[model samples]
Target: ELFYPKNKQHWREWLFNNHHRKDAVWLVFYKKQSDRKTISWSDAVDEALCFGWIDSKVESIDKESYKQYFCQRKPNSTWSKINKEKIEKLISTNQMTKAGFKAVERAKQNGSWTILDQVEALILPEDLKQALAGYKNALEYFDGLSKSNKKMLLYWIISAKRQETRQKRINELAELAGKGQKPKQFR
Candidate 1:
């Protein structure tokens, strides 16, 4: 369903009314201008998270607006550090719903509520750093990567499902960096 709530109150009301419906997905139309009289996207995301919803893809609608999709938080969904902080604030402020608290509890129990900050800080693992150091082109390319790209590359390697996979990815990533290319799946 698509909705264009003018402000946070409307969005909150909608969530309060519909949050228990597990099958629903919302595509919220958001105006993206500092001066506009609309709920900021960040505020919308915070509100959704408070109701145990998660934002997925965002699509540009036009020059002035975009649409962001929100759906029920799935079991075992990894919690980003930023969202964990947001949940803390929401709980302190008494905004989190029972559903939201349940989601938070699950994350706490499963240990997915942590920062993947090594990527953000661009602190390469010893093994990956050694591999890069051996290839001058890779080292130079890595040094020049924007923080976001560096995070993506490192997260890809760190999130590998197995040790052998992680090692393979590290090697492949170094070769790609040496060629001044991004991972094929990076956007």
Candidate 2:
């Protein structure tokens, strides 16, 4: 069976109606028109994770775009720190459940909880900046990136787990930018 929401915010109300039965196939759509007024993808994901749900995958239905096919979390799936913080906020506000708590405990026991250890804020790290300073043309191209593109690059960098990993990413990003390349979605 399937249920769909006009946007992510409405999904919260629907979750209430369903009482989070633990096994329902929910297809959440991201109608472009939804941008007219909605809570946004980030909020939606946080709310979903708070309730022990995770995004499975999305499928585009048409030109305007329609997202599909999400389901509740299974026992084995791990959690992200970002989502864990969201759940913690939910718990503080009396929004958590035994099921949700159980999931958190499982994550803790399996080391998934700490594995998500605090992510640094999304900002352009010095490494990328250093790389760009070395190449005038690349700096020009990097400066030409739209706000969204630059923000996405910063986000991708901050999500890196280790210094070596981030250095590698910086190298790749600099090489691409040096040749007038930006992140795929940047263009």
| Candidate with best lDDT | 1
| lDDT (CA) per prediction | 0.80, 0.65
Could you give candidate 1's per-residue lDDT for residues 1-187 as a string of tens digits?
A: 7788889998889899999965455554645453456777778889989888988988887777777788888776777768878988898999988888888888778755553656656889888988777776998898898988888888888788799999888888888878887778884
Give the Cα error of residue 136 in candidate 1, in Å: 4.3
Write candidate 2's Cα lDDT for 46-148 as tens digits: 5566566666676676655556455677664656656767887888888666656777788778766654232233245577889877765787787787765
List ranges where model 1 is wrong by over 4 Å: 30-37, 61-65, 134-137, 178-181, 184-187
TM-score for all predictions? 0.79, 0.50
Candidate 2 Cα misplacement greater than 4 A, ranges: 6-10, 16-24, 34-39, 118-187
Give the clash count for each candidate: 0, 0
User: How far off is residue 34 in model 1, in Å?
Assistant: 12
Q: Which ten residues in a row have the lowest lDDT in candidate 2?
A: 115-124
Q: How well does candidate 2 match the true structure in TM-score terms?
A: 0.50
